[model samples]
Target: MAEKCANVNDSDCSPAKKVKLNDEDAIENTDERNTSENDATPETELNLSNFKVTKVLQNNCVRKSICIKGTFEDREGLAVVLLEQKSFPHDESILEKGFFDEKTLFRKHFTNDIYRNYDCFPTEEYNSIQTTVIYPATQNHIEKYKRHELYMIDETYELYQQVTLPYIESKSLSLEWITNILEHKAEQESIIYEDSDKDTGFVLITDFKWDKQLDTLKLLALPFQKIKSLRELNASHLPLLRNIRDAGTTAISKKFNIPASQLRIYFHYQPSYYYLHVHFCYLMFEAPGIYVAKAHLLSTVISNLELMSDYYTKAVLSYVVFKDSPLYEKFKSRGALETSTCETLDCK
Candidate 1:
């Protein structure tokens, strides 16, 4: 949830004050392991039964996360309740507890406990949440949590070399980690699949966001080639693309037992980082940045390259640019997307 910043000096909005509030509200209790019934030892359940949901801010079933904008029946104003099922630790012993189990859930602090959610896994905890509820949630809170305006401007082959390319180069970002991974200096143990073919080679590693879970699985395939994002891919890169599409799929099937049918393999245009990488996640995962406006399917990319050697080089690509994105300022400076629709998806 966004920090409701009215004025930085506002006592209620101060980080110090929030920390103090969380400290006071922290629920001190032993791990209430596997309680199949209603609670007896109560500091209140932080129940949402009375929350009158006026709107759903975001709902991603793949990630088991939901955000709702609403007000409690007993409350006077709006509120935002974000509840997401906590991730499991990678520890095999704790991961044995599946969705079939009888288990109890605990929210460490009545207000802030997202960090403590992981502690419950070892206690046979099948589900828990690091949730946040912003009550009397003013329009300010709603605006902060509200989805931003996304303009899908079409970038042609000319626009790439002229406007977008210059804009991208102007921004300085770090990729030392990418180098470390490719050189085998980092994340050595986490690499589940690897190919050292030099040109078409890549190491498939587990993404931090996914702690080895099946449903919300996330894996990244980083190629040894120095090719930056999808923009750099052309006919000559078909081998690398096909390797990622075919070999990565086979490796995932062998390692995770997830069939090719159940996976979403794609590349992000205007990727979070400029480095080239392929993302693989459970089809149901709905991981961030998977919207059509950003994600280009690996299969589709392969076909595009197969059909036209310079498909990406000469293609007109439509992609979203968030207002807060680093690329946003660049686009604004160049008047790059000046004519695109600037519609806002407000919570109201």
Candidate 2:
């Protein structure tokens, strides 16, 4: 199994120094936290009320595989990637079966590699070797990520290099950072909406004539998680969405808290490119009576689809946007979606 690392606030500490905390120590720490919460003092809350700790200590955090090493020809199709830690809120219960809480511990390494980062830890199959690390549950910065793509660990390093496969450890952004970043982006550019005009409801419904032959395209909402290109979207008779300055799922979810049902998603095809436009009502989750509406743009699926003569397939990628949320802040920085380019309020 791979080696585990400790979680510590290292801003003031030296780089090479390492702190060791065994499983017993970790369990004791958890117990201590539980005990403190049980007899919580009001003054302790006051001490942390103003001072927010951005850095999380790595302990029982989850690791995600962002990039996989090796090609289909190398490992017969098995991809290799790295793992990084994730921190959750202390109050949230760590359940046995759920998303993001199942994985714990390291397994065996692939033939030539030293460490293996599996999707889930402690499974009977891959019990060779693995590494697990956790972080303190307070850090919530989104844009501070290390991996943009799975193979592209270093922002400065290109991912075109070939490497041995079998065992893999991905180098991606911490799950804490990814979650916060996505949440932050959603909060910022998501369109705000209001239900004040339920009497004068939407009228543009019957215009969309569904064509059976055009392919039943179920366009998924935006902020494409691991998808890097349009080909990966796997939509038929449609195109991928890109240039997500004001369009993305994260942006919409953060802004309104309403599902994608709140927006009008459409497809447009140009001679050279395809477009997806998401029209939404800009209503703040906090201010339900007030209504806000906006339209966001998405770019072509493939930058150079004209060059492909063989003609593989097509798909549509839908983007949803909301206003003023945590996701808004994160996307504003990543250039995924922004509020500055939105049209003026027409509901006035």
Candidate 3:
């Protein structure tokens, strides 16, 4: 019978390793290893599960070897002994204990109260694979990662989506085109309003729905004829300010302490802005590096915002708010005032 290979990567197969099926035939087969294959015998099932600790090897590294079994279904019952960085400086013979501790330890504190409910999945890049599947941990966040973006899974084993800031990619939607679309959309939908303060010099105000899924304002364009140079907005404009803090080891320096350098512009809506407070807090944590700590800090802060922000105000104006509007949600999650109570939208 002819044997077939499936699911396994090409690198795993070689002519030298092909199984001799019969007197004259050699099969380079990668058969389905699913547990449900009817042909698999009970004895085979027992052997599959009978994984035992075989060997542990560590060379020229600060950490020791850990070996386990049954964790990997495809491998020959030998599972790698993964250890958290905190567990380092341990005894090498500890591998004989059969199982390494599976507990996770947090080195630094989480500022969910000050920040909000935010989780960052570290990025994993495979040059061979050209697709990306975004698995956002929460419904509130907009997962923004492209196919070619470089990423890595950190010690926490979370995928971080790498982003290049000041990455200026301009969509074709210009102010004039956006204005036309809004005007047409407003005429059709009676709910929207367009106001131009002729006396106040070309300042146009358009209001529409706020889309929660897209995290964007439903309205296409702001009525302002021309927005001048935008500035880095402070906390005073929007009462809801969620600040994320993660202190890593390398960040300890003189420049960051005197004045916090803004890390990234997370949300920008006219005068209202939200930034990830990475520099100050991350430097203080004494983390080995910035990547893991930054992701943890940003994720925790966003998570906190989701819990406190008044959903009622955000709910009604959902249509006007741009769909997938990360900016609005960033502020709302940080604890925005009740839509009814906050009369002043003059964030600028």
Best by TM-score: 1
Minimal lDDT window, size 10, model 1: 23-32
**TM-score of model 3 vs. true structure:** 0.18
1 or 3, greater by TM-score: 1
* Ranking of predictions according to lDDT: 1, 2, 3
Q: Which stretches of candidate 3 lie over 4 Å from their true place?
A: 1-176, 181-191, 198-221, 232-348
Model 2 agreement with the true structure over 1-348: per-residue lDDT tens digits: 233333111111122211111111111111001222223476433221223223332222223222123222221222222233222223334323222444555344454566554554633332332222222222121211112111101111111111101001222223332232224331111112211122211111001111111111111222323332332233331232322322233333443244444433422211001112222222221111112121122322233343442222332223222233233333444544434333335543
Error of 2 at 49 (Å): 1.4
Measured with C-alpha atoms, the lDDT of residue 128 in candidate 3 is 17
Residue-level lDDT of model 3, residues 1-348, one tens digit each, is: 112211110012133212112222111100101122233486554332434434322211222212121233443322333221222113444432322333322234356767644332222221111111111111221121101112121111010011111211211112332333334432222112222332111111111211111111111113223322112222221222221111111121121222233332122212111211122222223212233212223333344445534321222121112212443333334343133232346554
Superposing all C-alpha atoms, what RMSD in Å does each candidate have to the true structure? 16.2, 25.9, 27.4
The TM-score, computed over Cα atoms with residue i paired to residue i, of candidate 2 is 0.19
- Assess candidate 2 and give its lDDT: 0.25
lDDT of 3 at 8: 12
Instruction: List candidate 2 stretches off by more than 4 Å.
Output: 1-158, 161-169, 172-220, 223-297, 306-348
